[model samples]
Target: MANAVPVADFLVLPPRLDRTAEMLAESARRRGMAVEHLSSPVVPARLQHSAGGHLYGGPTFAAAVAPDLDLVPLEPADDWLPQLPYEYTHRDIALTTLGEARWSRTPMFVKPPRDKTLPAGVYVDGSRLPGDERYPADTPVLVSEIVTFLVEYRLFVLDGMVHAASRYAVNGRLDPAPLDACAHRAAVLDFAAGLLDACADSLPSAVVVDVGLASNADRGDEHWAVVEANMAWFSTSYAANPDQVLDVVLRAAGPRHRLTLRDQAFTRPPTPFPGTGRSGSSPMS
Candidate 1:
């Protein structure tokens, strides 16, 4: 048989590749692309030109590999998509950092703006927040009104279009099911389109925008609401079409990416993979 030509390439961490990463590598190989599993968690300089791009675990990994590729590294998820409604006047949703948190009597969903150092959960009142030992007192956080997600979907967006999406959660649980491309999927996509249009200029060229069905008695019915944004490099693919997700992954961290002024401030060391007892770091914080 004639030697196959490569269509794409991958740079993955060895020993433990997440299901999504594994799927991407397998899919790429199936298509005659090359995948290199590295033990050092570093993207070698040689691959910078030969390989399409690298897929990192998180911002830290991306930062580590960036020096090898001589490319601008990625910013934290929070910085990439800062408190949307608060940063952008067009968004009605309320979002603020824990330090500046002013909500009393009302519960809010709080989570670390970038990494999983802090667990994401609903705080009945700001007073109940765990002590600030984990992160600095001034650490940025996402504090938003608790909204119910009847069904949540993760969309892989690229340049104003959603390449692929998957329903990953239902009623705040880990329920992954392929959404029919009919009414249900249409509803989710429609909601996403409206959101993207509303905040067209605010979002990055490539990122993951999560949306969900929420019921507002005052509004009288269930409608779609923003569930916050995640960095495309780190967000789980869930059940999203693997091939489509891989394509987004490639473009999201492709060579065209430029370093932001904030990337220089990203000096924190790499975080360990989740559930790997090898590392003392916490996962899904």
Candidate 2:
């Protein structure tokens, strides 16, 4: 009930029906929620309407819309640095090259810093790690310290509030094992909320905080670390519980706002700097 916001869908698929915002919105409607669809004429030609708040969409969406809507991104804009080799963030940090992470905790799980786009992987310092089915080295890969965990958990925060959470285990040991769900929940919420608050002004409408079991000094205790930050849009919802995620998005993605190209919305203006627009400036956001 705290996330009582109204939302509309901005379809990025062209009049061609190439995307799923309509279908997804319909599903929400059946659950007694309200969603609106915008007409192209009112929006800027270069602009698009996307669900999950474009947190995972192409940088173009952010570039075009940021100037019009006061949206801040939890992650970096696309085209910053290569994704962090692992699934963690220092918040609002930028990586200009792979060399920044030259010294890293080996056996890391490299993942991309930005979400929604492709050509990313979780790699080790130089080993041929598995999970390549989802991440091939063909594209730029994120090299991170490999973290094996009792389980991986995700927390979805909406408007500075803790809304929903889910935990996953490649192994089912934690299903009923003696693990403290509330503590992990608390850790994820505390860290993510602080990070979000740090960049609260630019926080997107919806985003997911992924928490991993990092090393702890408790000897045999399972340690938790913030592995990867992801957008709520295309996250597999595997480790995440379905109903809870859906509910949070439905509530957070609200009150459709139409901003004209001429309107000034986003406060943090990007510097055109002559040649930056030709390609995405940085890939990390």
Candidate 3:
């Protein structure tokens, strides 16, 4: 009998290995996959590239090596949140340019939909947003009504199912717990299923969705609402099952040739060349 080939031939990591990256690499190695930690943003000449290679790093690192490795990084559509039903979002969400958003006199939550170029938080008003000189006036942003989340959960979804989940935060603080150990596991999965049933088409097959128990300040009511969608390749596991997280990460940022027809639309456009952009700037590992 011959040795079986690994599902993913290679798993690439950034120069600095965080706990989450270390966890995924260990999981990948146990499954017979090779792990590569780049010494710098540049791919070394000695390293061989393969179509079966998958990357696990920030968007900047992905963009840096994409041209050479032929990696297809999957992310949610820019308008994914804005298009969702009000029942899920529980707030007014709009996709607009920074120029237009800067004119608003009222406070709101503003963030760059896919990238972390602009900070994600509640701004006092449009005037408090990053200056136009730092980000182009035309830079796209998601502006929404501010709501306080009492608890937050991160779900790693594959093929419209929650493969792994963790309670990442509570009361705006770090509080990691595995889904199986969570008291609200049933409610979390139930809410996730409903959202996926209605809006799975808006996201990639392998992605992360953050849902939270949000409090309405005026009404004093609490309900489940979507926090946001994130790329599995860039999201932190934070006590999620490492094996399951690896499963999604492999598919979310794997070989271009292995991408299914449904995921092709969600793939990030190829970077034409390396060393053409910034690096080391992801909110999550």
TM-score of each: 0.75, 0.48, 0.91
lDDT of candidates 1 onward, in order: 0.61, 0.42, 0.85
For model 2, the stretches where C-alpha displacement exceeds 4 angstroms are: 1-27, 31-108, 116-143, 170-205, 216-221, 239-285
- The sequence of per-residue lDDT tens digits that candidate 1 reaches over residues 1-285 is 332332354545444578987888877777776777776655454564333455646654565554444333233345533445432212233336665653455776787765666678888887777666665556677765565678888988876688888888888898886656424798877767776777745655666877877764445667666777766767888888888887766655554244343333422334454443322111234
Which residue pairs of candidate 3 clash?
none
lDDT of 3 at 190: 91
**Which pairs clash in the backbone of model 1?**
none
- Give me the candidate number with maximum TM-score: 3
Model 1 has an lDDT value of 0.61
Q: Please give the lDDT score at residue 124 for candidate 2.
A: 55
lDDT score for residue 55 of model 2: 24
lDDT string, candidate 3, 1-285, tens digits: 332343457888989888999999999999998898998767654443455778888877777775567568888988999999999989899999999999999999998887778889999999988885778898899999989999999999999999999999999999999988988899999999999999998899999999999997977889999999999988999989999999999999887778889987886544343335433222221
In candidate 3, which residue ranges exceed 4 Å CA deviation? 1-8, 46-49, 271-285
* Backbone clash numbers for all candidates listed: 0, 39, 0
